[model samples]
Target chain A: MTDVLSGLEAGFAVALLPLNLALVMGGCFVGTLIGALPGIGPINGVAILLPIAYGLGLPPESALILLAGIYYGAEYGGRISSILLNVPGDAGAVMTTLDGNPMAKRGEAGRALSLSAVASFCGGTAAVILMTLFGPLLASFAVKFNPSNYVALMVFAFASLASLVGKNPIKTLLGAVIGLMLATIGIDANTGVARYDFGVPDLLAGIDFLVVVIGLFGMAELIHLVEQQVTGKFTILPIGKSFVSMADLMATKWTILRSSLIGFFIGVLPGTGASVASAVAYGTEKRLASDGDTFGTGNPKGLAAPEAANNAAAGGAMVPMLTLGIPGSGTTAILLGALLLFNVTPGPMMFQTRPEIAWGLIASMYIGNVALLVINLPLVGLFARMLTIPQRYLIPLIAVLAFIGVYSVVGNPFDLFMIIGLGIFGWVLRKLHFSLAPIILGFVLGGLFEDNLRRALSISGGDWSILVADANSLVLYTLALLVVAVPLVLSRRKRMALDTEA
Target chain B: MADRIFSGLLLLVSIGYGVMAFTVIKAPFQYDPLGPESWPRILSVVSALCCLGLLARPDTERLDLTGKTSTRLVVLLVLLAAYAALFEPLGFVIATLLFCAVLARILGATMGHAMIFGVATGILGFGVGAMILELNLPAGPLRALM
Candidate 1:
């Protein structure tokens, strides 16, 4: 307990510096604007600003503070569009639209918005407290993990991702395989031989993960927006009042608390992000509600459940990345990339070697959550107005931003061509209903997975049985199999039940 | 179905990749028992198996692109390629200005509006890149003025 308190004290000393405070404020403001926009989400927001953050030459803690601020702030901002325009700002906000827009139509926009802010704060604070108490314990446990255990852990992450990411497990697995193949490009680390570089000089350096991320999330999204050309504009509703009544708060306090707990645990699992958490939380709340039939209508509990859950999930997703060196979501994957750029490896040793970056990020999240609530309750009107920006302007601006971001990183034109190629490929994959998150997660994990596998084999003198020789490895392998098997079984049971009903 | 054809092609590619992986030359002095080729070969095999599974259960979902949409997509792609080629020669400002203007027009903007927006974005992009971030963007023909 004393160690955690001292670590937090050191963290506060770093995060409370004037420069860090400014960065936190700037990140939250920019994140809110980006999140409030219709198509520009947290992923795009982070990718577009990543190079800029590097250019600023801020310290690692400050940079992460900024990026982390953008992450949670976007969660707060995504609800604006969902409540006001009935258009979800991002995938995680899709559930919010079920009851949020109806509440707005009934002239309770302010009530819905305020309740969401309060619920978000409650969820974020609860998750942060959990993180403070448990994050160190998890890291200490993971510190004892060896190469064989890491290999099994990576396999478990992959299995969980492939089985749970999308509706089609085969497609998700294919995407992951493609990602792994991409990771094998360029020179092999163990041997000095190039694997798949077709004699091109640029291929010798390998594909930049940032280049792939910008292409898939930023450029592909632009092309999709142009393809849809959705011109249906929404009228802005008036903000009648900006605070939820006492009765309103009392009614949904239990619902918010329940969903926050559910969301945080799910978020700690790799590959399960805010969208899944929010979906499951909202469904659970509906099932447990006294008036379950009022869920899809304008129930205040309906709006609060998803809003609270997603924010809590965003906080919970940090645990795996901070402790296990594996990203829990796409947004966290980019943050992990940022950590690598700062020469900080995120894993068990992070707390021992660099307590400032670990605990500072945790401390700043607490400050940032309060900052978001304080900022969101008042300026939400201004943020919501950002949705009125025309698509013609937004699309071109996003294209240029993506181009500039990718170009500035390597200062090579080949990366530009690579991004465009990846962009087209991503679009095609999206059209086929394949999720992009698994591909990215696979890419990020590919090098680590191979390294651990090879290290384990080398240590065991080429004995493949080392993978399952130990108790930890055996348990992890069993868990991996169960992760894949249970989902298939559950889905099959559901299908059979539907058939029987028919 | 389209998915079946795609999966079949993928299976062939995976097989080709696996075949090529076996051809990697070994170093004069090996560090470990398993060389660099093992992992790639393993991945290729996994990919081939996945492709075979996909081919067996190909999805029937298809995306139908209208002629106009397809043309617009092709034009945008070609323009992007052209912009990349011209980035160094024409400079960041001129090339980006042209790319943004054309892209805006393609997405349904008036000529006047597109040009105005494109020029503003180009100047602002250059300003942020070169002035604020201190990045050495190509000044192209506008080098002397700055």
Candidate 2:
């Protein structure tokens, strides 16, 4: 109890610093704008910012403060276009607009936007408090772990992520293994021998993370854009009311609490992400509504539930990130990497070594959430007006920001090339049925897997038995096996059923 | 080959890696014998087997490739490679401007409009990165101002 209070106190003190607050505000504002735009999402946005952060030399805590705002605020910002434009920014915001846009079309846009704001705050605030309470307990347990178990833990992480997505499991594994292989490129850290650099002088330093991120997300996305010759023009938004009335709030109080609980729990689970949380929340609300038939048709309660759930989930997803160092989504994965750059190793030790960062970040989130609600309500009119801007001018400026941000941080010409390369690749991946989540899961966990495997082996004199001998390690390993085989079992049963049908 | 694409990619990569893993003679140990490469390899092999299983009974969920999308992808890749090659020689502001402008045009922006954006982006980018972020951009001919 004392520990929790002290951490909270420390978080507040550290977060109050002027530099950190500026970063939090800047990140939130920028993140909201990007999220409001069509075709750009959080992963690409974060990847684009990576080089800038590296080049700027911002303190890790401040950097994280900014990135966290970008993440959570983007989760909040998607509600803008989703409510008015009838276009979902990402897969997650698809639900918010079902009724949100209809209400907008009916001139109840202000009411819908206001409900979204309050619901987002309720969900965001509740989850942040829950994270503050539970995250430390998880971290404390993680701190006691032996290095041998980290290998098993990494395996468990990969297996759980691999099981959830709906693609050919084999191909996903291939991409993940390739990521692991890429991570091992350059000189072998243990033996001091180069493994895969192919001996180029520059290659000796290993493949750069900036290079990989830009290539995967930036260049990939560009490719898709060029192929389609994409053109999206924004319409000017008329000023609308932005406050939810007292009567509406009183009517929806119970619905908000129920969905917030549902959203937070699901959000904490790895691989669930915001899309699922919103979908489940909508379904639950629809089932639980008294006059449920009006959903998808301009009802205020319709817009509120999914909006609340997704925001709530955004806050809840931080649990795995802060406590276990296992990120739940692409945005959180980027946040995890940013933390690593700060030398803030997550898990149990994070709370012990950098309670200021752990709690300060949590405290900043509390402040950041309030800032979003206050900032977004009045500003929504101005932002919605941005929809009227001409595309030629806006896209070029966005592109310029990306190039400048990338080049400055990496200080390598190659980094810009990588960004363009990956942007195009990302574009193609989006066009195809492939999910970027699996690839990221593969890439992030790849390093942890290899490092632990080598570390575990060196301890046990090359005998593999140590993996099974450790009790905790064994349980995690069993979980990994079950995760892999369960899908196979279900698929086989489905195949047999199909055969009978034939 | 289609079935083997996933399985074969894995099997082939694994063989190459397994052979390569031996180059370290003694194969240094960590706290255990697995070291850094062990678990990655174990996963590689297991996932490879899963691919093999899928290949043996290939399901017909074929992905259709559009010519324009594939062509766009190739163009994007080539353009980036070119940008990397020209970076040091062209310098920061010039290279980034040209790259951004060229990319915007290729991604479907009109040339005049694209160039205007490209130039604005290049200047503002250098300003923000250099002045505000305090990140050092390549100086080259711009060094006199510096």
Candidate 3:
């Protein structure tokens, strides 16, 4: 407890630096704007801004603070579009639209917006408090993991992702394999041999993670925005007075608390994100809340549950990323990649070696959540107005940013074309209903996966059984097996039940 | 249809990658029993099997990219390619101006609006990149003026 407090003190010392504070506020503002934009999510926002963060040459902690601010701020901002436009700004906000749009239709858009903001604040702040307590404990535990244990952990991560993230496990697994393949490009670090360089000079170093991120998320998102423009799905509903009554907050207080806890726990699980958290929280609330019947028709509890849950989940997702070096969600995966880019590997040792980065990020998140609540409540009117920004302008801005972002960071002209190729490939994959998260998680984890496996094998003198020889690894393997098998069995049983009912 | 084709292509890629891992990749000395080729080999095999799974369970998802949307995507691709190709030579300002203007025009902005937005973004973006961020974006022919 003293350690956490002292660490937080040191963290505040760093986080309260003028520059860091500005970055947190700036990132939250930008994040909210990005989140408020239709058809963009936290992943896209982070990916788009990552290069700029890199190009700015900010110190690692400040950069992370900025990015982290954007992350949860998007959680706050996603509700804006959900409430006003009836279009989810991000995946996590989908549940928000159910009651949010209904509230908008009923001319209580203001009440919905303000209520969601308060719920998000409650969720985000509660999750941060939980993270502050649990993060160090988790890291201390994870510090004991051996190489083989890490391999099993990686497997568990992959299995969880494949089973939990998307509809088809095959596609998720395949996407991961593809990501691993991408990681295998360029010279082998262990041996001085090039594996899949294709005789290209640029391929010698492998594809940069920034390039992949910008291409897959940023550029592809631009293409998707263009598609949305073509489809003509853009519309905005008029918002009335923007304030939440005290009664509404009191009525939904329990719902917010329950959803926040649910969201945080779900967020802590590797491979799950805000989307799952909000969905689960919404589902649980519908069963437990008093006005369950009005869930889809503008119940304040319905809006509060998802909003609170998603923000808490966003905070929850950070615990694993900062502790185990395993990201809990797609956005966290990108953040992990960012940490790697800064040459600061996130793991158990991070607290000891780079406590400033760890605790400073935590402190900044604390400030950022408050900043988001303070900024979002009143400025929501302005953020909701962002939906009116024509895609023609927004599209070019994003496209230009992608191009400039890549060129500036890498300074390699070749990466420009590479991003385009990757963008097209990513767009195709998205069209095929494959989740992009696993690919990134796989890519980020690929190096660690190969390194640990090789080290374990070396230690065992080529004996493969050493991978499961230890209790930790065995437990991890069992968990991995359970993660993979349970979902398949349950889905099959559901199908069977459906067949019988039919 | 798209799923099958993509998976088939993926299968080919895996096979090709595996063959290269076996035939082309070589280590001069081995400190460990498993060499560099082993991990790639394992990855390729897993990838091949996954590709097979995808091929077997070809999803019925369809992409409706016909009409003006498809044309815009293609044109945007070309513009992006041009932007990249001209980035270093034409400089960030010139390349961005042209690309942004054309892309804005394609996306339905008036010609005047496109040009104004393009020029503003180019100059402002250059200022932000070179002056603010201190990025090494090529100045090209605009070097003398700056």
Candidate 4:
């Protein structure tokens, strides 16, 4: 307990620096604008600005605070479009549109907005508190993990992803394998031989993770948007008196608490994200509500449930990334990539070696949440106006940003071609209903996975059974098996149940 | 179906990749028993297995790209390719201007609006790269001015 407190104190000392504070505010403001605009999301926002962050040569902690601020700020801003325009800014905010739009139509846009901000504040704050208490404990436990245990843990993460990300595990597994294969390019670390360079000089240096991320999420998203011919006028509902009474806050306090816990737990699980958390929270609240029939209409609880859950889940997703070195969601995976770019390896040793990065990020979350609430509530009207930006401007701007961002990274024109190639590849995969998240996670974790597997085998003289010899390895393997198996069984049962109903 | 064709292609690629993995020359001073080729071999085998599974139970969903949409994508891709090819030779300002204008036009902006936006993006992007971030973007014809 004392250690956590002291760590937090040191963290605040780092995060409260004038430059870092300015970055946090700037990032939140930019993130909110990005999230408010239709078709631009947290992923694009982060990927576009990542190069700027790198070029600035800011300290690692300050950069992380900036990026993390963008993350949660996007979550808070996503609800604006959903409530006002009935257009979800991202996948996670899709549920918000169900009741949020209806509430706005009834001239309660301000009430819904205020309720969402308060609930998001509650969820984000609670999750950070939980993280402050649990992050160190988790890291301490993970510190004892050996190479074999790490291999099993990676397997668990992959299996969970395969079972959880998309409806089809086959596609997800294929994406993951492709990613792992991509990771094997360039020079081999153990033996000084190039594995998959194919004689190109640039290939000798291997693919940059940032290039792939910008291509896959940023450029690919723009291409996908273009394919849909996204040209139309958006109608934003006016914000009436922007204030929620104390009675309104008191009414949904229990719901906020319950959804925050639910979202945090779900977010902590690998492969699950705010979409799942918000969905489950909304369903759970609906079932528990006395006015269950009023769910899709305009209930305050309906609005609060998903808003609270998604914001909490954003905080929850960071726990796994910071402690276990495994990203819990797609956005967190990108954050992990950023950390790697900063030459900071996230894992058990991070707490002892880089406590400032971990705890400072935690401390910044608290301040960011309060900052978001304060900035968003009064400037809600200003932020909502961003949705009026036309797709003609937005789409071209995204493309240029992707180009500039990728070009600035390696200062090579070849990376530009690579971005275009990967952008098309990502678009094709999206069209086929294949999820891109697992592929990215797989790429990020692939090097670590291979290293651990090789190290464990080397220690055991290539004995495969050594993976199951230790108790921790044994438990991890068991859990991995269960993660892979239980999902298949449950999905089969669900299909059978639907068949019977039919 | 698209899924079957994709899976079949993947199976072939995995097999080919496995063959390539075997062809990797062994290092003279190898320390570990499992050499550099081991992991790739393992990955290719796993990929081959996954591809086989996909082939056996291919996803029923088919990609539905209309002619117009597909044409737009191809045009956009060609424009992007041209932009990249010309990026270094033509420089950041001119190349970005051309790329942004063409993209904006393709996305339904009027020619005048597209050119204006393109010029703005070019100048701003150049300022950001050269001035703010201190990056060394190619200057091409604008080299002397810069």
Positional deviation of residue A418's Cα in model 3 after best superposition, in angstroms: 0.4
Candidate 1, residue A101: lDDT: 85
Question: All models: lDDT?
Answer: 0.85, 0.71, 0.91, 0.86
The clash number for model 3 is 0
Report the lDDT of model 4 for residue A280.
85
Ranking by lDDT: 3, 4, 1, 2
Docking class of 1: medium
Candidate 4 lDDT over A138-191, as tens digits, reads 999999998989998888888878877777888888898888888888887777
Model 3, A103-197: lDDT tens digits are: 88888888999999999999999999999999999999999999999999999988888888888889999999988989989888998788788
Question: Model 1, residue A53: what's the lDDT?
Answer: 74
> Candidate 3 residues B8-120, lDDT tens each?
99999999999988887889889897888888899999999999998999884578677877888888899889999999999989998998999999888999999999999
Cand. 2 TM to true fold: 0.88
Q: Using TM-score, give the best candidate's number.
A: 3
Residue A191, model 4: Cα distance from true site in angstroms: 1.1
Off by more than 4 A, model 3: A231-233, A496-502
- Clashes per candidate (backbone, < 3 Å): 0, 44, 0, 0
- What are the models' TM-scores? 0.97, 0.88, 0.98, 0.96
Worst 10 residues of 2 chain A by lDDT: A221-230
DockQ leader: 3
Candidate 4, TM-score vs. the true structure? 0.96
lDDT of 1 by residue, A1-502 (tens): 9888998999888889999988888888888888888766677788777766766778898999999898888888888888888878667889988988889888999999999989988888888888888899999999999999999898888888887778778888888888888888888887778878889999887788778888888878877778877656667777677469999889999999998998798788888788888899899999999987998889999999998899898889898999999988878888887888787889989888999899999988889889999999988889978888878788878777777777766778888888888889888888878888888887777888888998999999999998888998888889889989997899899999999999
Which pairs of residues have clashing backbones in candidate 3? none
